[model samples]
Target: MTLHQRPSLQSVPAYKQGKPAAAGASKLSSNESPHSPLPSVLDAISEGLGTIHRYPSIAAPQLTAELAALHQVDPQHITLGAGSVEVAAQLIHAVAAEGDEVMYAWRSFEAYPSLVRIAGATPVEVPLDADSKHDLPAMLAAVTEKTRLIFICNPNNPTGTVVEAKALEDFIAAVPRDVLIVIDEAYVHFDRSAVRADGVELFKNNPNVAVLHTFSKAYGLAGLRIGYAISPLEVAENLRKVAIPFGVSDLAQRAAVASLHAADELSVRINEVVAQRERMYEALEVAGYPVVKSQANFVWINAGDDTLDIEAKLADGGVVVRAFPGDGLRISSGSELDVDRVIAALASVREGAQA
Candidate 1:
């Protein structure tokens, strides 16, 4: 007899990781920090190797306290997960179940649909606006009695478009108090916009709001897989309940703590990344592509049907970028050489298109 599996799982799509580049090509497929880990972070990780035989602290008390102090929130409101994505999954399970609905912007995060379906909730997707930002008005209109949770990816993945502060605050005020609003601020550090929504501040006044952050992005800790949520005390408690035992490793916890201490160094690195992102956005626009105004560490080119063709050309030019097939392309801001190669590749592709 064939082994039994959950029927819902058969239709669930596996998460697709960014493709790796060949030798000599710059891999900007993943929106990761181009800079190396701070020396202090490296030292912390090396020191943690001494405890290889022991299990990591289940509570991760020290790291939790540091984060609490940093955000000026009660430690009770903080919850750690393997990554923010894992925390998102936990939150979906905590609030929604069979027959319930989880809502988010379509093309916001590729993982949203899979996460909702895994929790046995129906995924309700609202399409993005013409500019590629979340259509919050439409998203709020889609909210039905069955809607339990909504995810708003600020500086949304793949597009790097943000819903400005005033607009976002208004949307929060209008949303039903019972429905949880998850502000996925994964790219907040790179956002230089004057009107960017402060997710942490928003979470404090609104008990129904939860802010998901990841060490994987700004802190250069993708391999370590450490992330956390600033949520209401009850939600935080439930997140802990669903968390995998010994999920945050000793190295990850210590490294994150050290990284938090080196804020000045991180700020300098972040500024450089932001500068590069702006340069890349402008360069793409001048090169004749319809590039979105990005506030994150990546630029989005609305290539539509030409995505694959441009992606192949970029790959041939020793540069790699993430392409969303028929949607567009997402290219991470990297070193100067990487940016130069991207410009050249884009110019070459546009010329070929015209011919």
Candidate 2:
């Protein structure tokens, strides 16, 4: 006999991960930090390894304290999880239930819908405007009585477009005070724009808002899966309730603490990545591709109908990039060598199209 499962789950799609590169290919699929962990972070992780036999502290006290101090918030206002993604899932579970609605911009983070579905909450996706930026006006209009939560992926993944500080603040003013708003800032380190929303500062002012951060993207700790959410005490308490026990490993916690202390070093690395991102953006623009201006470490190419074909061409040229079929291509600013490969691949595609 077949085992019973939620019928709605049948429609849920598994998260699509970046494709692996072939031998000698540059992997620009995942928006991972091209650099290795800082030396201090490595040393910290090494020091923590001897205690792996023991269970990791469920509270992750040291890391939590470091983050709290960094954000100038109480420890009670912060909740740690395996990653910001997990923290996001926890947020959904804490406040949402069957029939509740979670709203976010469409063509945003690919994981938003999946997380909403997993929570048994309805996903209300408001489409992005022509510039591939969040249409805050439309999003505000879409908010309904059933809406329990909303996600604003600042420096939104894939597209890498950002909602400016003023626009974001105005949108917050319009949102219902009771509806939970999550600012996913996984790529915040890469964003240097003066007009960018300071999510942490925003959270301090807005009781219903939370800011999500991760070590995965800019911190180069993706493998360790450490992230945290800064929210109001009540919401943070609920988030911690749903978090998996010992979710933030001892090694990850220690490394994250060390990472905080190594801010100068991290700043240098981030500047390098930002520089590379700009270089790639210029290259794409010069190559006549419709690329979105990105504040994240990755750039997006609106390849339109040529997306899949260009992706295949790039793959064959030993440059692997994340392709959304007909939508566009998302290419991470990886190593300098990888950026060269990407530009070369784009040139190849352009030549072939002309032929």
Candidate 3:
């Protein structure tokens, strides 16, 4: 006899990661830092090797304290997870239930719908506006009485588009107090926009608001899988309840703390990534591709029907980018050499069309 699975899972699809690049190809499909780990971070990880047989501190007190000091919040407000994605899942499970609704922007984070569905909650997707930014007004209108949670992916994934600070503030104010709003700022470090919304600042004054951050992106800790959420005390307590025991590894916790201490060194690498992103954006625009000015560590090309073709061309030039079938392509910034390969590939595509 077949094992019975939850009926709600029938509609859920497994999460798809960015496609791995072929040999000799620059892998820009995943938004990851191209830099190697700092010496300090590496040393911290090495130091933790002896403790592998033992369980890590369940509460992750050290990491929690570090993050609290960094964000200038109470340690009680912080909750640790394997990654921000897990923290997000914990948040869903904490607030949402069967027949409850969780809302977020469409084409934002690929994991949002699945996370909501896995919690047996209904998913409500509000379409992004023409500029690919979150349509705060539209999202506000979509909330119903059953809406238990809302996710605002600032500097939204895939598109790398961000909502303005004032607009986000107005939207947060408009959202009903009963509905919890999660400001997922996984890419916040890469954001250099003048009008960026600060999730931590918002969280400080709003009881219903929570901010999600990950060491996976800018910290260059993707492989280590450590992230946290700063939420209200009640929500944080519930997140701890839903979190897998010792999910955050000892090495990950150590690396995260070291990474934080090595921020000055990390900033140099982050600045380089930002430079490459700007260069890629300018080159794509010059090649006649309709690209968005991204504040994150990637550029979004509105390739429309040509999405797949462009993706193939990029691969042909020894570069791989994330493509959303008929929609567009999201190219993560790599080294300067990688940017050269991408521009060269897309330039050839433009020339071929002309021919």
- Candidate 2 local lDDT, 1-355, one digit each (tens): 9999989999799998899988888889989899988889999999988989999988888888888888899998988899899999999999899999999998888988999999999999998899999999999999999999999999998888888999999999899999999999999999977678999999989989999999998889999998989998889889878888888889988988999899999999999999899999999899889999999999999888989998998887798889987799999998888888888888888888779
lDDT of each: 0.91, 0.91, 0.92
lDDT score at residue 131, model 3, on the 0-100 scale: 90
Candidate 2 lDDT trough over 10 residues, lowest sum: 58-67
Per-candidate TM equals 0.98, 0.98, 0.98
Worst 10 residues of 3 by lDDT: 58-67
All models, RMSD in angstroms: 0.9, 0.9, 0.9
Give every collision pair in model 3: none
Q: Model 1 Cα displacement at 114 (Å)?
A: 0.5
Model 3 alpha-carbon drift over 4 Å, by segment: none
- Which lDDT tens digits does candidate 1 get at residues 219-243? 8898899999999888888888888
lDDT of 3 at 95: 99
Strongest candidate by lDDT: 3
Q: Write the per-residue lDDT of candidate 3 for residues 56-173, one digit (tens) a residue.
A: 9988888889888988999999999988999999999999999999999988889999999989899999988899889888999998999999999988998888888899999889
Model 3 TM-score (2 dp): 0.98
**lDDT, residue 256, model 2:** 89
**lDDT score, residue 275, model 3?**
95
